[model samples]
Target: MYHESVMLNECLDGLNIRPDGVYVDVTFGGGGHSKAILARLGEKGKLLAFDQDPDAQQNAKLIDDKRFTFIEANFRYIKKYLRLYGIKQVDGILADFGISSHQIDEPTRGFSTRFDGDLDMRMNQKAEVSAFTVINKYPEDQLHKIFGMYGEIKNAKTLASAICSARMNAPIQTTGELKTILEKYAPKFKEFRYFAQVFQAIRIEVNQELEVIQEFLEQTPELLRDTESRLCIMTFHSLEDRLVKNYIKTGNFYGEPQKDIVYGTITKPLDAVSRKPIEASQEELARNNRSRSAKLRIATLSE
Candidate 1:
């Protein structure tokens, strides 16, 4: 089970890649973008790819090309990894931010609501925390906030109460087990969509995906070359999209505030490429349903 990169052609076109310049594919799932970058590069060009999942290494296809290098690490450490490789900056950086299809389709991976497996949703296997730990160990208040804030679920407090209460009877070990407990709290006549949302929230917290993206976005300007350095990010959910949108627009998660007479402030380090995000074309959406939620945002580092 491997992930098909969403909006593949559209992202490549947005990058405006230079044939002889260095590039980075930060979320190298299935190595789809990395492979495309490889095809577009000349012998003098280079592409560096990063993925925390070891399984992703098997999907990396450009091992034979000296122009390409794959690092088994998170994109949040892109600057560090690049520095270690004697590289300082890249012409373009592409990030497809979300869980891979491979993780969701594999039942044991437990990333999907449809799966009935252990509640282990660590994208990086080395991470100590998993959904099981969060569900069973986190305080009720923390769980309530995560569910309500990330999942945007109604009655988040009630749902949190149910989990805390049920786990005391028996440890919630698997997705199926947790689903059974949460289902009771779910409105009896409500659609299945609500339950799915709750599960998604848990997965997000378990992986610390939002925090990682926040760190990664903060470093893009420092990692890219001064002129025409493109940063393309594809986010599938509202929370993730909001972070990307704000960062691109104001160079901070919060919108920029007016300058005070007592303190001076400068403008952002990058400029938004489009006033709004670029959505996949109708043709692309029809071919891939997963593309439906994807919003692509691009920015150029200030020179």
Candidate 2:
């Protein structure tokens, strides 16, 4: 398993799985959560999972359970893929959205700041827009936007300018080369954080994570069964968590949900089961460092 499914027990709690209820693990990275779901299910219970990464496909092969079905595709097409198996609705859906540990540890895929690998941070190896493309080919303004919006970097313009100037001389092909160019802009006291934020911006741009996540969340209303159904999402970043929090509270991804002034109500298909997100317990954090930033939010279909 490349990534330890963060907050396992908590995710299962949010799932509220029934012995025979149908479930979907949208981000079945290591199959930790999927395996757990299966453990709680009856023989008849089914688990349908999706992960586009070839590495994840290899891990999926280790599972011998007939109740599990792995879809070798991105979860953005959740509803479309589920329909292929004659599944219209499921009792629950779980999404653990972020890069896996193996992707970072492998060094070749270039997801970790600690690695000197090539600038290839595509979650799906087949994806065209890699870190190289984002850094070397993207317009200065677009780079600035990605850095600012995705990375939340305060000096986004300066970072973008640095990349543009560096790339003009020669294309930045590797994570090390990109880091060297932006090293001057990195904060002296907090170099690691600066580089992390910068890398995060490029990776997000390369993968179109936020947009894809929004699309995935947008489809949950249709995939989930009414009232009894649950949608559990675990986000590792603020941009993702904010969108999930807002979407569950409001049908739209915008600021505030539209309201019926006369009735004083906002009728959304989903409602937040808990007002705040669930964080990993101290025990889980000690066991796995990756669970530190995980925030699990659960919602259920409304009446």
Candidate 3:
């Protein structure tokens, strides 16, 4: 399915785009945001788009403009890859952390709980790990940690045990098989939500989602070319949003509040663009259920 970008207008406005500026769209799935950025660029402006999934590169529109370049690589290596293009810094960067509709709607790619397909949720198909390895090969204790930390499942221990037990009989290879195993443990009232949580946890572990975010956040300041350079990120879950928000406010994840630090004590490289996260409007939410969980956080590089 064609992937429609979330928070399109809000993100573009957040970037405060300039026609002559260079920008990066880190998650270029379906070219949704990348296309929008191109429309706003002048003949002299440039846009670099990155998507690791090679199939996604096929979606690149036939724009003959020399201003646009598509990079086939995961965004975690964004800094290194950009440097290869002689781009040491950028004017603005936009990242939509939500899984693209292209990945979810394609049952064969297998990102959705609704789809009865192979449990392969790697954002970068080139990645070595897949849901199969995470579920079948990962130690029970590690699985438990992923469920508890990433899924935040209340019955993490039991669920992890259940998965381990089932895999002993046979490998949990597909979404359908995994769902059957999880269904036996899901509470009656919260069955569906619990399954989603458990599956999401597995996906996160398989993809190393949290670690990627940490690396991406740490690399943000180095990418901004000017003092006013912007970082606009759209996150779907509270965990991801928390990382973005905290990173923008404080360069470090866990430390005493920086607001109390004396002058010259330490300088934060980013300045908050909004006091609070921005959410989809009522109209946008009604049209797209995916927009409901979306939260946009913006920050500008400090001088």
Candidate 4:
């Protein structure tokens, strides 16, 4: 399978799709969600999907529905692209944020810790920065910050120092070479987790995933048609989930809300449909291990 859509039914239910309402799938990795959305839509309904990955573009090409349109750009520029398409607002927007299964399964992509590919983790292959550049060219302090902040890895400073020292011998060329260095610093029995964390950190930096997510989310309020419009996002890590949760609860990346001093009214663009994030069911967990860490949060425009 190119990618199995996690929480598929849950996501669809959260969307509460209208037969004739327009929708946007911001992360059209495998087109699984988009295909399902199309199935639920009427002839007049439209679905626009976005992906920067060339591989995904190919998958998108396989779909020949007149109601569907694929945008070959990053979702961060959602507003600009939508405006260009003459779409100012949509009924709902869905985002599944993280690396795709196809990217990880292909060793050349360098997204999986288990793979031995070139350290190239750019979501958009054309992007200048890659995991190779981050590991070999970044300064020790910058690496330290990336590992500590993005990966949430302890001893990040030590790991950064080790990377700087080792790369001086030669540029860290591949995932295997990087893993060899990481194995030394990884915890006694937690090497796999450590490697995943480090690779995730580097990947995040290379793709600027968090920044893109924020920019994308910031544009969603204006893009949504009204309070009935939904925004459903699935995040794989705390860093991503935090941003989504905070934005929904407070209308900013920060969890604190901005209040009007005169009337003491809190200003937030979106309201959470559920009090807490929704996780996969036991049945789904049994089928896909990747769904274990997945969290789904649904929101709507605040009144």
Candidate 5:
């Protein structure tokens, strides 16, 4: 199985679907959420889905609906691609971000820390950057920043120095090789957690994920038509979730909402529907282990 989408029912509910409206699934990983969205859409309704992974395209073939159009592209260009198809605005947009289960399960993709594979964690196969390049090629300072900022690893400095010192002998080309070099540093109790964070840091840098997310969020306000139009984003980590939360609340990626000088009122483009992110239900939590980290935040375009 590629992955079961987290909070499937809640995502559909938050969309505030209009049977005939236009919708876009920015992260059409396994097509689980896209199929659900298409079910609610009328014959006249259109659902444009985006996935940069070539593997996802095979999954897209399962849906033969004329209402569905699969775009083999990164969602950072959501507005550009939709415009080519004459979609200046959509009624709703749904994004389920983070690596899919298929990518993690397939050791060849190098996403999982469980099974050793090549040091490659690219979501897009064609992308030039890979985990191998980052580990062996990047300087200690850059690696330190990536681990600290992206992975939120507490001992990022030591980890970065370890990788650099080990790589002086030869390249760390595989997961097993890298893990072996860092063995001494891995905590006795939280070894898996440490490796996962290290791997996540490399993966994010390879994909430029946070930057793409920022670009994607910036486009959402202009993509939706009006107040009734909604944006549903499912984030798997705190960094991405924090960015989404801040953008929704402040209309910018940083700090509080900009204020109007005369009235001292904040100017924002979207009003968050739920003050807190929606978490998975007990039933969902029991089924998918991934939902524990999943956070669904929804907001609507303001008038």
Candidate 6:
């Protein structure tokens, strides 16, 4: 499998799909969700999917359905692309965030800690900034911030100093070389988890994943047809889940609502369907280990 869709049925139920409604799958990695959406749609229903990764684009090509149209672009520019296709609004929007299984499994992509590959973790292969650039070119203070903020590593300052000192001897070129440096700073017996956190921080910076998610979420209100329209997002990590949760609650990333001084009304674009995010079932957890950390959040336009 290219990538197993986590919380598949839950996401579909959250979508509340209308048989003839127009929908979008912004992160069409393996097309598992997109294929399922198409199965539930009627003849008039249309499913437009977006992906910037060339590998994902290839996966999309195998689907030969008139109701499906694949857009080879980042989801951050979703509104602009939808307009080009004469689609001002959609009935539902689904986004499955984080790196895909295919990317991690492929050794050359450098997404997995177990694999010794080139330090290149760009979702879009054509992108200039890669993990190599982040590790080699970024300053020590910036590295400290990325490690502490994105990775949540405890020894981030010390790790940053070590990386700078080691790079002074030679440029950190490969994943293995970086891991060698990380091994020295990593906590005893928790080295693997530590390595993953550092790699995740670098990947997030290289792709600007958090920034893209906020931009994509900000556009959802205008794109949704009405209050009936749904927005279902599945995130792998806390950083992602927090953004989704906050935006749904307050229509902002900060989780702070703008109140109308006179009427004491909170001005927000979207409303949460549930107070808490939905987690994967025990059945799914047994089936796919990757689903363990997954969180599904649903929202609709505010009345």
Cα deviation at 74, candidate 1, in Å, is 1.2
How do all the candidates rank in terms of TM-score, highest first?
4, 6, 5, 2, 3, 1
Question: Which residue runs of candidate 5 sit more than 4 Å off their true CA positions?
Answer: none
Evaluate residue 60 in candidate 1 and report its C-alpha lDDT on the 0 to 100 scale: 76
Pairs that clash in candidate 4: none
Per-candidate TM-scores read: 0.95, 0.97, 0.95, 0.99, 0.98, 0.99
Tens digits of lDDT, candidate 3, 1-303: 487788899999998898999999988888888889999989889999988876677887555568999988878898999999998989999999898876877888778888899978888787889998999998989998999999999989998899899999989889999999888888898888987798789888888888888898899898998777899999999778888888888776763356544664555778788889999999999888899999999998876
Instruction: Report the lDDT tens digits of candidate 1 across residue range 17-68.
Output: 8999899998888888888888988889999899988778877753678998
lDDT, candidates in the order shown: 0.86, 0.89, 0.86, 0.94, 0.91, 0.94
Q: Give the worst 10-residue stretch by lDDT in candidate 2.
A: 249-258
Candidate 2 global TM-score: 0.97
**Candidate 1 off by > 4 Å:** 187-190, 257-266
Model 3 worst lDDT window (10 residues): 255-264
Residue 83 Cα positional deviation in candidate 5, in Å, after optimal superposition: 0.6
Q: Name the candidate, 1 or 3, with the larger TM-score value.
A: 3
Clashes of 3: 0
Worst 10 residues of 4 by lDDT: 97-106
lDDT of 6 by residue, 123-182 (tens): 989999999888889999999999999999999999999999999999988899999999
Structure candidate 2, residue pairs in collision: none
lDDT of 3: 0.86
C-alpha RMSD between model 5 and the true structure: 1.0
